[model samples]
Target: MSWKQQPAVVSAPPSEDAVRIRTRSGIAAVLFLPALFIAKVLLLATDKGGRCFVDDIACAPFPDTAFGALLVAVVLALVAAMAAPVRVARGALRAQLLLEAAGVLVVLAYP
Candidate 1:
């Protein structure tokens, strides 16, 4: 078929509900990073002699590279989360959550 003969595809714009959901999700994602950072910093700061929780289960010490990676991840996640409305934000939030969770798990796994 010719270009004009081909079926035309029209995409609907984002709805109000979608927008609200995205804004909320983005806000949550943005908040999550800083909160995690603050908590981790506090936990580490309180630990005497640079030692963390027993066997470092709760808060394991992290190397500079790992910490830098985490920081970059958080910034990227926050940006992604804030980039669009609800549906897009939800996806970004999920990714951010997974990344953060994986990082935490890795830290916990260390002796």
Candidate 2:
């Protein structure tokens, strides 16, 4: 090639292996949302209900039935999320995130 018309350094698209790795990573990241939700629910259920502690301070009590219901909902959402395809999974993930965020916001803002 002439100096004025040097050959272009074209790059090949990602190989199948690279594409597969990327897809796996994407799915893993997406799945993490549901996993996180489930973990939080389980942690909350197992841990004692409390806001803070002091020399003789006590935290507000919450109902077991309410907590149990919350756990059930979280588990259901997790199952749906796992079963969904990548395209549908995104919607489920967004919904779970939104619900969690909204719940937190309401608690903090109201309480």
Candidate 3:
């Protein structure tokens, strides 16, 4: 088709709810990961069975190295989400939240 024959494209501006949701999601992406990580850390530290064999003053139950790495990854993902373009930030935050929710469920369900 010739350029003159093609119709012009029109796109609607994003609604207030959509922008609000994205803004809130971005803020949640920035906040929730650290809170979740802290909660997990507290849970691990308070589990009496995992107590350290050495100096009690300097020791607490240490979660798996993999878990620590996962926490770091979540933080990095949050940073990425915040830096992402407006259109992408919402999806990034949603995906991060889904991953975090799954991680929380796994931690809770583990025997």
Candidate 4:
């Protein structure tokens, strides 16, 4: 390689800690969104006879580690708020959330 071409130093991939920090920051951003943050309370309150499903609310942000936390969180909140009959949705939503949590946790732990 020419001296001028190789003059600058090569950059390394971000450290695991840095990557995890960035991921957490991104998740934090999702959580700080006003509407998303309050989704649990609103969904439960508006739910008539516990018939509402996660799909009722557009699962915004698609499926990602950061947003997944929000999804699981909202579900947990709703489940906690529900009475005797827990109407947890029956589909990939729960599984997806679980996967996200696992993925994020792995990243956080080993990134």
- By TM-score rank, best first, the candidates go 1, 3, 2, 4
Error of 4 at 52 (Å): 26
Candidate 4 stretches with Cα past 4 Å from truth are: 1-5, 34-111
lDDT of 3 by residue, 34-65 (tens): 76666556655655413432234445334567
Model 2, 20-94: lDDT tens digits are 444544565566556656554554444232223222235454345654565466455545555555565555555
Give lDDT for model 2: 0.49
C-alpha lDDT of all candidate models, in order: 0.63, 0.49, 0.60, 0.42
Deviation from native of the Cα of residue 73 in model 2, angstroms: 30
Candidate 1 vs candidate 3, lDDT winner = 1
lDDT, candidate 4, at 36: 41
Q: Give the deviation of candidate 2 from the true structure as CA RMSD.
A: 13.2
Candidate 3: C-alpha lDDT: 0.60
TM-score of each: 0.46, 0.36, 0.45, 0.28
> How many Å off is the CA of 24 in candidate 2?
0.5
Relative to the true structure, candidate 3 reaches a TM of 0.45
Per-model root-mean-square deviation over C-alphas: 7.4, 13.2, 7.5, 18.3
Runs in model 3 deviating more than 4 A are 1-22, 26-63
